[model samples]
Target: MNFDEFTGTVQHRLELPGTGEAVRATRATLTTLGERIQAGEATDLAGPLPMEVDFYLTGAVAEHGQRFDWNEFLDRVAEREGQTAPDDRADVAHHARTVVAVAAEAIPAGQLDQVRDQLPADEGWGNLFELVEADGAQAE
Candidate 1:
């Protein structure tokens, strides 16, 4: 429903907070944790895991503020992620715009998802990804 909730769910599923690199210490931890789980060496899958990470972004363009709608935000996230939601577009758009403003100001190129994970699920990730994609497209 919100960015934090969404990220928390993802982090829980991944069983580890992501490190900045595609492969890093977190990967090693996951492997070991996985082995432990498989061996029944650990009782709870969620508890033994390390602390969740917060991948925030930073840049100059990120400072200029903007606004978006929550419904639109959800729709965009669903659209980008290839999922479906039964919410009205207008309502979601409002939250989306607000989240976009925050991401636009805070995130840098390398840590969009990290920063996005900190946002409300219903409002920030979609706009943040859009900006990241736009920047990536322009670099080509």
Candidate 2:
């Protein structure tokens, strides 16, 4: 998807207030999610995404092997999103879920699956896959 289409999808999914909010949410999630998964897998996932998004997910990272669970995932998102307030974490996570759901549309399923597999299931990051569900239930 193009950048506008991407932002539109994320805004619609999250019922976000505006395109600006959607942009920030998208970037925050893409960057944070990139950090959560293996660098190689993230690069594969970024291959089919838009240039704007690809950079967000794969820019300047010499390594992307760090692993963290849901909480840390949200924390990183909040930091990237500039939502420094403690209460902003929940909001960041909520937006991040929508961002991932929207990202699912752009990423090839196989590459997306690779991302799912790369997340340490035991650490709870595997829950990221549920962000886009057939029944419309997102990762919690």
Candidate 3:
């Protein structure tokens, strides 16, 4: 999928009113994700994505990603998404899951595997990709 389709699918999947909200969710989730994933993994994962999608992960932090768990990761994404209200938790999880699911559809399987495998195994960070994998499985 190209940028338009990618964003459109995000909007449709999330039942958002327009591409505008999808773009907002995508940018927030993807950029914040860039901050959590290793620079090299980010680059490799970005390689197969559309230019617009890849842009978010392109200038990843110089250091190897920060040590943050899945909940904090969601918090950052929710914060970046401008929906920090106490009642926004459900919306935040839905946004994160939806955007990542749609982007996962556009990414090449090989690259996706590299990403899932490359992430740190010691931490519960596996939850990061769990949604994407589950989404992919459901699609099949």
Best candidate per lDDT, number? 2
lDDT of 3 by residue, 19-103 (tens): 8888888888888778877788888767766798888876634444766766787788888788889899778777877777777
Residue-level lDDT of model 1, residues 40-77, one tens digit each, is 21222222122231121111122212344434435444
Write the residue-wise lDDT of candidate 2 on 5-109 in tens digits.
988888888887899988888888888787767777878878777888888889945458776678888887888788989878768877876777777776655
Index of the highest-TM-score prediction: 2
Better of 1 and 3 by TM-score: 3
lDDT of 3: 0.74
**Cα lDDT listed for each candidate:** 0.33, 0.75, 0.74
Would you give me the overall lDDT of model 1?
A: 0.33
- Where does candidate 3 stray beyond 4 Å? 60-64, 118-126, 137-140
Report how far residue 129 has shifted in candidate 1, in Å: 20
Clashes of each: 32, 0, 0
TM-score of each: 0.22, 0.85, 0.82
**Relative to the unseen true structure, what is the C-alpha lDDT of residue 13 in candidate 1, on a scale of 0 to 100?**
34
Query: RMSD for each model, in Å, please?
Result: 17.5, 3.4, 2.8
lDDT measured at residue 19 in model 3 versus the true structure, 0 to 100: 83
What's model 3's lDDT at 126? Answer: 64
The TM-score that candidate 2 achieves is 0.85
